[model samples]
Target chain A: MTIQTLNPAQRTIRTVKPMPLARNRFERMAWIFMRFSGLILVFLSLSHFWLQHLIVGTHQLQFGQTVARWGAAGAPVTIENVFWRLYYVAIIALAMLHGLNGFRQVAYDYLNNRGVYRGVMIAATGVIAVVSLMGLVALLGGATIVK
Target chain B: MLNGLVTTVREGARYKGESNQWMWIAHRISGLGVLLFLVTHISGMSFSYFNPKVHEALIEIYKTPLFSVGELFLAACLVFHAINGTRIALLELKPEWWSEQHKATRASLLITFVLGAPTLVIMAWKSLSFYLATGR
Candidate 1:
């Protein structure tokens, strides 16, 4: 014999409860990424600044100097050592994504209209992508090692 | 008008009792500051591709003692933001660790100081020596 539970009117109540609505998974992931990338950027960017400016002396830092540091032998090959180029590329990519997300958050806070919010997000994405591409190209083009 | 202003100020000052609210606010501010710096930095660095001479000139301007001091402040902001951000990430990703968040915050602060203090001191020493030698 099964015992049934019912609310005052004598109708049996269902045991299973409705599931909660799906959460914004992507937004949650982006939020997590921001925190993780931010921590890493702190170390990467600070060290980059110290090495490039404080240690080498900012006055002495020039395009040619940066090219050499990236391991280019002067022409054609661009990135002689893949590791250094990759290191810089990673920093650029992470920074762009993290900053763009922050920009989106600011927009979400201020913009009430959905259309305007969407527009801001699109613009932010475009800017981040274009700028990151430009940075990569500059790093590669400037460091091209001609053999 | 004066009453309204006072009310507004009082409302703003009221504490909501979230232990991590101050840290969250600082993280947001520093994150925005870093973003602002990135805009200028990327734009200036991009000049290297268009005109090397202009890029070199920009680098020279940035080398000024005044900018060096600014860089130190930027470093402090980034350091605090990053360490606190790490704590937030850990708490959010590992739900089981939520109970220890206050401890995490303290740890993050300690770590930031440990790393940031030396970096600041070294940067200050270098900046001072450079300005003194150049007399700029």
Candidate 2:
């Protein structure tokens, strides 16, 4: 006895749908950036921790120590000072961006309403931009370096 | 209820080669861990702009033995998350490297181990010494 197969016309022919590309390229870039910046931040922040907390000890993290290392005043504008400033800039920028993107992801997941989502995104961006600018100013401003 | 819990736990214990899923979970956890640290750090660092005396006091409090131990845990999470994240970013962004994703993952793990072992030792040494000295 031979088995009978279904007719081609009666058989189901399903087309596989392609995965949807992310709607917001900026958000996609931010997602990719969170991972990239996070990797760099781990090295940066951990080394900073080692130097500030472990090596020098947190008790020694006074204004004088910070100013001497990072402050632009009194300290000559030497290569080391410039390097330290750049380093702070990198840390501040990376941490702020990465953390903000992570917050954006959380907001998207939790806030389903479109208006609320838009508001959250705007608020997060504003906060991150303002804080990052303030941080840069505080870090680079020579005024904190008391003579 | 107990049976259901046991069944769920047993199912979770089995790994069927879903590397991406595991990486995603670890990335989320590590991201959150770093964010938690960031919140405290940002607030603390801001104090530098304000009253220096209060900043110094806060720093002194953090110098306690407990925080040293916490730092070790944070370091571990940060190291793993960072390494794995780098691997994912490279694989996703660089189409040429997609074929070598497995190799890249292994390499990332090796790098994480190499970097993390020293950090773990350093943190352990610091914590132990602090605890021994403080007897707290």
Candidate 3:
């Protein structure tokens, strides 16, 4: 005299999972990348703006001024110089990656053509690579900051 | 194409959303502006390595009134984008708080204005006074 239950005829429809339509790991990584990089950038970027724009006047901003901050052109490298160079490198690298990824996101919104989107991303990547390398060479090249 | 992203989130893009739509639009616009500036900016910095003369010329252009004004605008974009981004990250961390997103958006904007305005004003004053003095 036990109550009995019968099996359902078919699988019940599941509720839609609340997740972005990330087609692959890269897409998921990109989503997470924005958040993490953005978190760091919130401090790095704003302080940088304050430093460059507020702390330093427009007229005072010269090529020599920036290079001098990185390190003396011909003087021995100090720990502070290495620190500034690394700080700049972090900002440049992270900002480029974060900013370019954002640009790509917006581009994808308007660019429905897959081929065109791919081409644009490729070009963007090239610019990021070249610019980042250039920044590295400018900040760390011709001088041994490690010493 | 832009409709879905600017208009909705989490829900299917086809659905109409509320004022938070503006935040999405603002983030994209500000981010794009920053990106464009970054390209030219890093290029000029790097040019300091490969080409010193070119870098000096580029830096000179940056000191012009127009570019200084552009610099102010860039600061605005950066500040807004940073605050707004923090809001987005916070909401993402607590998905349930997505219900209060519009409130968060307003707060973030308000905070941005409070913090960013004084700095921007000071920057503008500095830029103007310097240009006046140097006549450059």
Candidate 4:
């Protein structure tokens, strides 16, 4: 394996420059996802906050009220209804994806033990998935209060 | 984790901190805080399907003075995380400009505080009014 005694294939390898450590493609995608999702969420989430908390004021927040705004129990599929429904769905989807991925990133960062990290990641993914599913189900049409 | 945080802070107290170092710490802390809130919020709201009563009560609690303060903190965390994240993303996109990160971190933080101050006043008005009326 000495360079002076290199075979043709070995000499070819030697002639080429050393490559940089391979980047994890999944991680690179995740990094890109985080930035773009974050940029989008800034607008989505802020408007959501302004609408729900600031304008409506948490004082007036109620299940019936939300059901109404969420459309149907509130109103028919008018433009306003469609707008709010779409808005809610967008925020829910993006925020959940962004938040859970962020949680995973931190878990990878601080949890050095492979077994522990795996357990944590599995549990987190399952829990977040189930909860988010329930949210989407309700948003689509699961239950709206009679009131 | 709390112990680790305490240890890191204690150890780092020996040296003068760099702005980016402090900014990174703030970013992690705020991100984690928002993540926790997101979990609670989605989980709670998801109950609106199966248990509208529970959803009502949970959402109601947020209107209380105590919860208003917590909401303020959550909002602050969200705003800062969003703004600082923009800074990080910008720097990452232009690696050559990382040389200007110290300035970026300062500017980001100043923006966070500027945004946060008005937000605090506006939100705190709700909290103060609720407390004044109910003494809660």
Q: Who wins the DockQ comparison?
A: 3
Q: Model 2: runs farther than 4 Å from truth?
A: A1-23, A35-43, A57-62, A72-79, A110-134, A142-147, B1-17
Residue-by-residue lDDT tens digits, candidate 4, A1-147: 323536765653334444444646667777899999888988888777767777777776766676666654433555765676677778778888888888887776667678888899899888878877877777766346656
Per-residue alpha-carbon lDDT of model 2 for A54-108, expressed as tens digits? 6776544566777666654445566766777799889988887787777777666
Interface RMSD of each: 5.5, 6.0, 4.1, 2.6
lDDT of each: 0.74, 0.70, 0.80, 0.77
Candidate 3 wrong stretches, greater than 4 Å: A1-23, A142-147, B1-16
Q: After superposition, how far is residue B54 of candidate 1 from its true place, in Å?
A: 1.1
Model-by-model DockQ, in order: 0.31, 0.24, 0.49, 0.40
Worst 10 residues of 3 chain A by lDDT: A138-147
Best by lDDT: 3
Q: How does residue A69 of candidate 4 score in lDDT?
A: 64
Residue clash pairs of candidate 1: A75-A145, A75-A146, A78-A144, A78-A145
**Model 3 RMSD, rounded to 1 decimal:** 7.5
Order of the predicted models by DockQ, top scorer first: 3, 4, 1, 2
DockQ of 1: 0.31
Cα deviation of B87, candidate 4, in Å: 0.5
